[model samples]
Target: MCSCILLAALKNADEMLKDIISAVDTSGDGKIQYEEFRVFVEAAERQLLQLFRSIDRDKDGRLNKEELQAAFRRAGLSVPKRRLSGFFDEIDLNHDGFITFDEWRDFLLFMPTNHNGSPLEAAFSFYSSIVTVNPEGDSLVSDETLEGLGYFLAGAVSGGVSRTATAPLDRLKVYLLVNTKTSSNVAIAAAKQGRPLVALRNAGGPIVDAIVSLWKAGGLRTFFAGKLLLGWSRVLSGTDSHAGNGLNVVKIMPESAIRFGSYEASKRFLAAYEGHNDPTQISTVSKFIAGGIGGMTAQFCVYPIDTLKFRLQCETVKGGPQGNALLLRTARKMWADGGLRAAYRGLGLGLVGMFPYSAIDIGTFELLKKSYTRAVARYYGIHEDDAQLSNVATAVLGATSGALGATIVYPLNVLRTRLQTQGTAMHPPTYTGIVDVATRTVRNEGVRGLYKGLTPNLLKVAPALSITWVCYENMKSLLKL
Candidate 1:
């Protein structure tokens, strides 16, 4: 008889709660808005206050570090005192050494807690009230403005991180490119010995030579030489190229932005043309075409910087002018010879290489991501969107794509660098144009010379690109995109 009476009372309480919810739902969409939900939170504050008072051993209305620590301990957490101090620092928004009633209320209802409990469940419920996209939904705010922030931010962050991580390898590549002493000796040794492959293998490869050179120069620190200055210079210079020529001018940011923007825009356009609402439905070939177009656009705008940067890095490596003097001299020389055109000496070759490189890199990454997403979705019987891969998976796929693309497009990189650095004082201008550079490279050092520093190139490209893509995806996820 007592159990039947309790069940009847529970049913009545549920119906009353439903009545209150419906009454507060002004939009009549069967969902309560954030403002209405606040009313519910305010009503529950009385119950929360009792618990707060219990933790206040000194009968004070505020929570100090000690009180907060006690609360965590009561919840079965064994956080260190230092960590507890950090937590107090966070909760004490005004930093007045105490968590006030308002702050405590906010923390309990809004701040994320690692522990799972009734309070955390309530906080999550409150969080869900603000992230709606429609007026009919139960939300206080719209997330429409944040829609594209993720993708753009992801690309930018990834590009920056990748470039920074691969600075050492890139420095090595530049060093090898300008100083071909080790490679020249290797080639000579191969020629002297009838067995070219055996002789080449016997002589230390570019990696060993680079390592020895870097150590002689200044140990591991030498790899980071000019890193800080070039890094900033690349940012100041546009994305595709650099205002500072000596830093490889291949600034990753502009290329990433333009490349991602163009690819997305092109994909959208094609999808619209095909009457497909879903952008991902666009075919791989269409994506390739879009990537090609995007890559060409970005590289063309930045090619002049590309030329200047190559000259700058090469000159610096060879111990030419040190700072501003170098920049002024290079500018003056280029101007004296051909003005603006001189600054864009090897654009034709750059365009040729960039198109294929960008297209292959972007297209391959997208395809791989889709494949991974699909596989995960199949395994779990979920929608493709819901099966997004983990951060590690995304980063690995990005690195793989970058490595593959860099290998295929490496010869062009070699030729472009050689042509850009040829006219300097140490290496007299040998090539009049792209054809001349290519022909002379083959004639002078065989096909191998065209790929002088490929080992470092591959090492840098793979990780740099991987970091870029991985960072991008991670940022997007953080933004809830």
Candidate 2:
């Protein structure tokens, strides 16, 4: 069995090497010249630099054994102590106890051609050594477990970064969403209150007016309100009361991790069910279903946190619990009102929106990526299997998918925001349920009321998804996933 596995791995490695060589051999000379080799080396070096930087948390430019071990653990690839010691011994050329960039690069570059023994063999040996022996002496870690960790980490980091960067726009969107009145009404109210920038209402439109209002109310800080949670702060500061403020990284990280992780898992399951061993062979409909399932799962798990975020953002518009205790106060109030049910006030509507939103978002992105790669391959007369999308292409596809998905389910988003924010301290519950909310919104604010906050939402979704996919893809590449 081990021999068969080794042979299969070697065969796959050969095929992969041929594809890599074909991709790098742009001139079609059937041979790699100095310049082509130089270009490939440069690109590989850049990828290595990214990986090195990620692993080098202290940024001192050298990777200690502990750092490498930590990085492996973080990526979900656990190496046994004996295997890790062997790896370190092989890579640490100078025996100086640290692996420098040069040593690391050389070892990887020489891995495929090492005459004494290939690292691929070492990998198989390592895997074999780590597996638990069953009654028949055959127990290996499943492929599913091996494949999920890097994606989870990538999704988490991307989600945190994108959410933090677009926090202001996100906050504004929630505010506008729950506000429900027209831009004209807001402008009129602002003018009556002698608020700043009422004169520019007609010139700059609702979005600009909203920004000015938020700014005038609390200056630049209000744009990022509710971002920093008291719980996170307390944990960071080692305080007992869990009262503090800061970025919403914690809320978004797990949400994103679950999203991408589940999406990948679902795709694998669907592919296996359909008898398609290759991921690239999965149908578009399967991708859509997987994406929807992923989105729904993530949304359901994190609905309470999302509700808190929306409530906190809306607090600026409506009076509510304030300051570092805002999150705790909000949670206490929700529990006091209806226990766990209140925390998930708009969860049904959110799930409704999430299905179509995530389906379209992920489905469109995957479809576009495959199509774009094929088109580029055809245009350049290269093998389609060897074609790869550039970063710019990935970003454009991400933005397009995000905008399309958000637009389709935008009305549901508005309704969800309203449902979540209702019955708060400042604003009494105006609508009883989803039906009442939709009916009252359409009746009082007209059809356009359901589309409130679409502007800032699009503004946030485009770049946010774009950055997310870009970062995620880059991280995956660096992790060799």
Candidate 3:
């Protein structure tokens, strides 16, 4: 129960002293008794260890004020450079300036963050509350609920990243999909005169290039276009299948017991259909459940972005300096001609696309990882005792499995793109109907035409999918749930 051990895990010297005092002074006597203080010291040591690993800078077992500032910076705070001079002054309720373990504990226990402060601080407070509630397994509830918490965190983090990086590409994609009809009208006069279309507008580049070019022509703002939503879509669909598949391999799969006010009836049906904890009874069907649920959830939530994308692409490009008005014009046009239903042109195709894309990608990835993990463990003679080594191996195997799965599901990517791009275009898809769309693609482009972008799709998705599984497995082990 030495003071050093209790505070050793905290590199931030300010919080350390406060934590010590909070732990020791539990009695209402406003003083520390020898027996009670000793017990408090022991509890603080365990907690400090967890917090240190959670935020320690260099594994050196000590922290200074500068290191604490670095941790805040890593968490994306924009504190001023000189704030460390009295960093703990406000947080240290005991006026010690340097917090012992007890004072740190007391400050954390009653840090009133909700009704005031910057948005960033509020978000941090919310995130901290969640981690506190579900530190390990969220065993305060069932494993399924804990898994749900994992999904929430995964989506928030991954979705945010995805939205930022891919927004431009998605905007470009939508732009191209909508502009061909407008172009067809422009080229009407050229066609009559037997003249070639302008060089840049020739539509002869790689098809994706065409999509991007049209987006630039239309000049839409980045606006997250569809990137943010699409990223979460990836994680949600990935988490649903990947997590469940991994859980299934366990001796006993976890069932979700938490339910909201009216979801209980539906949950019962879901449980009934899923056979209620009978892992042996689950087959390929179970894998699709998560993909469908995740995709549908993500897609519906961001349908407006999808609509804006289409509007940006499809508006007629009237000549003169006013073409930028395409947005207002498209909105007005859609409003005058069609309502909400107009924005949902490809809704049917989305549902159809979700199942195969999610199922093929996630199911295949998890299955491959499962096989690879077993083979490696068998060949290398891995044992339960080698926990750390086994975990590293699992991540590697999961990544490999993801690559293989992406390759297997390559065709689905083409189908998904076609479903999104075709039919709903400024004009209908090339076919008179869905059957015609299929036949014409095969007839003109050959059978491989249906999978025009297969290679590129695999290249894009393989690492992404692999990383998703690797992340999920690593997180599971880290949580030790």
TM-score for each model: 0.62, 0.67, 0.44
Off by over 4 Å in 3: 1-147, 166-225, 228-285, 300-304, 310-337, 379-433, 439-449, 470-481
Q: Model 3, 1-481: lDDT tens per residue?
A: 2224323333443443554456567775667798886676456446544554444466655444555555555555543333333344433445644444454444343232232644335433432333332323332453345545554444344333323443444444344323232223334455566766653354334555554544454434332322333333432344321111111111011111111101222333454687653222244455445444545545555444455444434332323112224434555555554467555545655556654555555455445555565566777787312213344554455445445644554444344444443433343553333455556566655565555534444443444443444454444444432
Model 1: colliding residue pairs: 154-472, 158-468, 239-254, 245-308, 245-309, 246-312, 246-313
Q: Per TM-score, what order, best first?
A: 2, 1, 3
Poorest stretch of ten by lDDT in candidate 3:
251-260
Q: In candidate 1, which residue ranges exceed 4 Å CA deviation?
A: 1-150, 178-203, 211-250, 317-319, 425-427
Model 2 residue 125 CA deviation in Å: 13
116 Cα displacement, candidate 2 (Å)? 32
lDDT of 3: 0.42
User: How far off is residue 204 in model 3, in Å?
Assistant: 11
Error at 197, model 2, angstroms = 18
What's model 2's TM-score? 0.67
List, in order, the clash count of every candidate structure. 7, 1, 25
Q: Write the per-residue lDDT of candidate 2 for residues 1-481, one digit (tens) a residue.
A: 2222332344234543665577678798899898997887777566656777887889999988778767665554535444455566666778999878886666554222222433334333333433323334355564346558777888888887787788788878876777755445555667778875864454347777788888765666677774533336653554422122343655688889999999988888897889844455689999999999999999998888777766666555423334555656666766886788877888899999999999999999999999998999999997564577788989899999999999999999988888877876434555678999999999978998888888889999999999999999888776656
